[model samples]
Target: MQIQVKDISKIYGTGENRVVALNSAAMTIHEGDFISIMGPSGSGKSTLLHIISGLDAPTSGQVLYGDTDIHKGNDKELSAFRRQKMGFIFQQFNLLPVLSARENILMPLLLDKRQPDETYLREMTGFLGIDTRLTHLPHELSGGQQQRVAIARALIAKPAIIFATSQRAILTAKAAAKW
Candidate 1:
């Protein structure tokens, strides 16, 4: 799916403390494109990603996935859209504490009640170099290791798009280039 962003603006607060996080930002995400939005702190990189992915709504303007406006639907529709078509790799490792690395990576398949193709799962895990860490818990892994687990989880679903921070992007790209 191609994502088109038009005049996207994200504003925070009002009255005395208003801030414009993003202003008239525009971009196109082509199918199979590996995009990286880079910036320092408070640069609205996350905000842009959120708006484009329909995870966060822009205060004004439009985000379209193909020909459909991403913010057109209600929350329920949006949630389902994300569940079915999107995968996210957050800067914070949002792994379930109680779940093992394998379980965390498979959470999306579980939530959608789809049995993961075992052969593909094995390939992905090995490709990302997390095959040996599957049995460990998130707490048992280092920060980089946990991040790889999150990457594995995101990639396991084979979604149309995956969003990640810059630091996480490098890690994921390196792991993916392994095979």
Candidate 2:
């Protein structure tokens, strides 16, 4: 899938309290592309990702995935689109505390009513170096280990695109190389 991010902007609040998070930002992302948005803190990197990925709406303009304007879709349609076509690795590890690493990794598949492919699951976890920690809960893992689990979870379904914020922040160079 190719992504086109047109002249999108995100504004918060109004009057004196208003903050412009994004302004006329535009870009194009094609399949198999590894693009990174870089800026100092509070420069709308996350905001751009949210708008482009349909997690949040832009104050003006649009984000399109091929011919479909993703932001124009209703909540349910957008949710399904995100689930089936995109993967996300949030800056904060969003692992469920009650679930084991394995369960967290399998959550997306379960949500889609699809069964896990054991071979792919095993290889993915192994590649991310979380295979031995699968049965453990998030709290039982180290910060890096938690990040690895999150990364594995994002990639388990092999979606067409992945949106990640600071995805390598917690990982070492060696660990990131495995990604």
Candidate 3:
């Protein structure tokens, strides 16, 4: 499996205030596989994504990518892993207001101190139908357009897994369909 999550559990708060988010959830995902997680509100769907992407650590259990334990890695290692091995799409469209679409797409490469691959980047923008809007800011685009830009940014990183969440659920469904 490309991704293996074993016996994972997450709890928020402590004592009387503690809330159990995930309880011993396990899953295995292979490369090129498309999976969708759906459930009622507060069902740990988003929490599962966070654990799989190494964005949040489980209170117990293991998240393995290949043979390495993701949570066992150091912070720098985990950050690098996230940058290179995971893509994230949030419903809010977390684009920098100051950066253009192109710049926003290039943010990951720039963070890694690597130059953006112009050909691939252009291809991705074209694929997402945002090539003409490369110079436009997020505010200038519609919600759907902004979401497309977010998708492009996520794809540019070439991640192993993409985690997304939507409170309204419709956006998540739409985004998943678009993807």
Candidate 4:
């Protein structure tokens, strides 16, 4: 899907303590585009990602996925929309401590009540080299291994847009994210 950001700005705080996180920032993410965002600390990179992914709203302007304004919806609406359309990889793995790796990786599918294509699951698990680690919980895996599980979780649903904040996860995502 093509993503368009128009006249976007994100401001935080107010009065003397006001901060402008983003200002008139705009970019187009074409379908199948592989792009990297680079900036120093507090440069609005994360803010932009959050806004574009509908996790956070911009202070002003529009973020369009095709013709639909993602920020146009209510919390529940946007939440469902995001679940159906986007994926995310956090800097900190957000796996559930109570769930095993296989369960965590398949959470989205379970939540959406979608059938897991056994063939695709096998391919993805093999691709991530986590086929044998499925029964282990998050704490049982190494950092890199845990990160791989998170990546697989993000990929299992085949979301159209993926927003990632980790370098290692991003590298793996770039390799596996094929349209």
Candidate 5:
């Protein structure tokens, strides 16, 4: 499996205010596999994604990417792992209001001190049907268009796993299937 999570558990707070975010949760995802996690509020979907992406550590159990234990890695290592191997899509289209679509899409590559891959960037913009809107700011676009820009940004890195929240499920499903 490309991703394996075992006996994972997460608890928030303690004593009377304790909340179990995840309870002995386990799952496996193979390469090129597509899956959906559907549930009502407070069902641990976000927490599971966070743990798998190495954004948050579980209170107990382990998250493995291939044979490596992600939780065992230090913060800098985990940050690099996440930057190079994972893509996250939140419900809120998290785009910088001041930047144009192209700039926003290129932000990750810029941050990693790498030049933008023009061909890939173009392909991503084309795939998301936002090529013409590349020069536009976030506030200038409609909700769906803004979401498409965010999707392009996420795909620009070509990560192994794309973790998406519920609101972006439709776009995420489409992008995952396309890739």
Candidate 6:
């Protein structure tokens, strides 16, 4: 899906504590583009990602996925749209401690009442070197292992667009390259 981010701005707090994370940011992401947003700490890269991906609302302006203004959707509609069209790899590995790696990786599909394709699942887990860790819970895995599980979960549904924050932050250089 092609994404169009209009003149969006995000502001936090009020009075003396007001912080402007993004101001009049605009960009167009065509389909199949491997765009990366790079900036130092306190910059608005994460904020932009969140807004563009419908994870957060822009204080003003619009984010459109194709012709639809994603920010206009209600909670359920947005959630469904995201599940169907997008994959997200968060900077923080947001894994459920009680769920096994397999469960976490399959969560998206399960949420949509769909089943996993065993062949694809095997191929993906094998490729990521996490096949042996599928039964392990998040607490039982190493940091890198957990990150790999997050990556696998993002890719399992074969989403059209993958929004990642610090995709390589935890993996070894070689491991990051494969992803």
Residue pairs with backbone overlap in model 3: none
Computed on alpha carbons, the lDDT of every model, listed in order, comes to 0.86, 0.89, 0.88, 0.88, 0.86, 0.91
Per-residue CA lDDT of candidate 5, range 138-173, in tens?
999989999998888788888888887766557778
TM-score of each: 0.83, 0.86, 0.88, 0.89, 0.86, 0.85
User: How high is the lDDT of residue 114 in model 1?
Assistant: 83
Q: Clashes in model 1: which pairs?
A: none
Each prediction's RMSD over C-alphas, in Å, is 6.0, 5.0, 4.4, 6.5, 6.1, 5.0
Clashing pairs in 2: none
Q: Write model 1 residue lDDT over 117-164, tens digit each, in one string.
A: 889889988888889999999999999889989988888878888887
Worst 10 residues of 6 by lDDT: 165-174
Q: Which stretches of candidate 3 lie over 4 Å from their true place?
A: 169-179
Q: Once superposed on the true structure, which residue ranges of model 2 sit more than 4 Å away at CA?
A: 167-179
Flag regions of model 4 displaced more than 4 Å: 167-179
Model 2, 1-179: lDDT tens digits are 78898999899999999999998999989887889888776899888888888878999998889899998879999988888788888778999999999999988899888899999999989988999999999999999999999998888888889988774455666587898
Can you rank all candidates by TM-score, best first? 4, 3, 5, 2, 6, 1
lDDT of 6 by residue, 87-121 (tens): 98987889988899999999999999998999999
Give stretches of model 1 more than 4 Å off: 167-179
* Greater-TM-score candidate between 2 and 5: 5
Per lDDT, what order, best first?
Answer: 6, 2, 4, 3, 5, 1
lDDT of 2: 0.89
Model 1, residue 96: what's the lDDT? 94
